[model samples]
Target: MTVDPFAKGGLHQAEAILKAHGVDAYFRSMAARTGDSHAVIDGRKVMLAGSNDYLGLSTHPAVIEAAVNAARRLGTSAGGSRALSGTLDLHGELEERIAAFLGQEAAVVTTTGFQANLALSALLGRSDIAFLDARVHASLLEAARLGWGRVRRYRHLDTAHLRELLAAAPDDAGRLVVTDGMFSMDGDVADLRALRDAADDFGAKLIVDAAHDMGVLGNRGAGLAEHCEVEDGLDLITATFSKAFASIGGVLAGPAGNVHYLRSNARSILFSAALPPASAAAALAALTVVETEPERRTRTLDLAEGLHNGLRTLGFDTRPSTTPIVPVRFADLAAGGAFWAALFRAGVFTNLVAAPAIPGGGAMLRLTLTANHDETHLATVLEAFDTAGRRLGVPRGPDLPPVRLTRGDGRRAGRR
Candidate 1:
């Protein structure tokens, strides 16, 4: 008899658990009308609390115009890798814009933020001892795994533990300390200043994946390094244009010589096609918006604060998060699935994170915010949570209103 490779592994186990809980709703297809605060899921219009479009620039008129203009001028795709025929003037413009925005000497754009991390990991960790945070993004972890280096993971957000790990490593070994500027799942900002200090003390190069922080943190939206007032201390910074920039690409920015080295040595950059002309233009335009419209950042942060407070008041455990990505924790996968379905039925869409994605094998409803969300939107979200929490038997604080189910037409379907 032939054996199925996945029949005995984690995939098979996951299937079993998903089946048991009827939680397959988590994987169902949902489409957004635009990258806005609402989406169409299973033909129902739902509020989008799960998106990464922090500044709400995804649907901005100028960004759309720039993408259209670039496509009209340079065709749809780059047609080749940057090493060959793919390097467009638009790409160079985006790189310059990013470098200028971040106060970095140079910047290199890649196909995705994940690819940027992968390329850096392959290059920087090839001969170094890579000390990674336990909760870093999977892309960085995969990069470390692929590189020919020894990898050690310390407790999440524990700089003291990080120092211990650094102290244990060989004195002569090339060391690389990698972490996320703002952890995506937990929504917590990293102590970049302390991490930079640790790196300096141990002679390790610090790489910060600021994908979640770009356009959301700092005075001018320059990201975590700027937010921490340690812009000059970081050795390298990587971020994605997909989130706040409302475009699809990633950037690695740093000293000119280091960026030049990545351009010449990173295999992903050499082998993969460059970012499309439309994406490059869109990213550049989005950067312009980030620089010009400071209120968008302020509004986004304000809305996030409102939601975080509301959730906490209702007795949800949203830990260690101070950013737009807020995760409401649950005890297990079943409870998370039920809570997610309850919210979905109530016309609020959120990302349900479960085992394998979440650390420590728990689950959470990953709620994110955008500047487009208004006071009414926040009110509606809080109301939905109240209803969902009640129906699911989750604990709640006092003074919340009774449960009400919302129909597809945005009217109250029924009251419980």
Candidate 2:
């Protein structure tokens, strides 16, 4: 009897684990959202603690109006590839706005964030050796694999390891270093200034995927490069509009000459349909909001700090996260599943990350906060966590001082 190739493969183990844990919750859908903080899931109202809408601009009046106006004027779709007939004045305007916001000479917009990375890897990696951080996003890893260059991974956030690898390379060989500004799963930030210095010393071009940092970090919300005051040192910066911009597209910004070259040569942009008019309009409007409303960024960081402290005080291990994205560490896969289910039942929603997303036998609950989440919403989430922690009998760490929530006036107050 011949063996069936489709019968089993690498996914069998994961499938078994999912079955054991009741796969119902993994892909559950939300029926509707009342606002940025609340969503209807399985006919129950649950606080949204797993979203990436850092600035809560998705439902903002100005953004919605811009999208609506674009749709009414230009319709929903860009009918062809950007290289063909898909280029719109709106697209050009959005690119210019993004380049100005990021303090870059030029910018190229792609259909998705993954495509931006893929284009870079396929184009640049062909001639250069790609040195990537071990914990970089999977899209970057896949892109490196597809590129013609030899790929090497340095230890996560270890500039020393990166420098060693760079030094060991042939003197004439071209080099490219890639990393994420904010690691998605762990929510820890990269030391961009150190990385920039190392890359400069080794004559390697640096690419930073700032998807999670955009609209949340930096003095003006240009992302981690600006946050680290290294904007001028980076060779290239890429980010997604899906998170903070409340739109669907990706942007790659750099020197004018390099960006022009990619506009003509990048296969993804040359062959794929252009970003929709509504998305471009929405992103432009969102950028305006990010620039004008500094308080939103302040509120988001404050909320994340409060939540992280609250979790730690309750004996839960929240990894070192100084941003709006927080990860609650679990002992193992089973424990994570149980905790997630409990949280769901308690009217709180979170993303369960396990196995392939995180190495080893560990798991975590990815809880993201947005600027629109108010004090009431946070209090309910904290209460839900306390109840779930007790019910699950999860181990706690040393008790710390109580965390204080920031008041409406921007002062820290109300310790619990």
Each candidate's lDDT (Cα)?
0.83, 0.83
**lDDT (Cα, 0-100) at 72 in candidate 1:** 97
Show where candidate 2 strays beyond 4 Å: 1-16, 125-127, 398-416
Model 2 lDDT, residue 366, Cα: 95
* C-alpha TM-score for every candidate: 0.91, 0.93
User: How does residue 384 of candidate 2 score in lDDT?
Assistant: 91
What digit string (tens of lDDT, one per residue) describes model 2 on residues 342-363? 8888888998888677867677
lDDT of 2 at 112: 88
CA displacement after TM-score superposition, residue 98 of candidate 2 (Å): 0.6
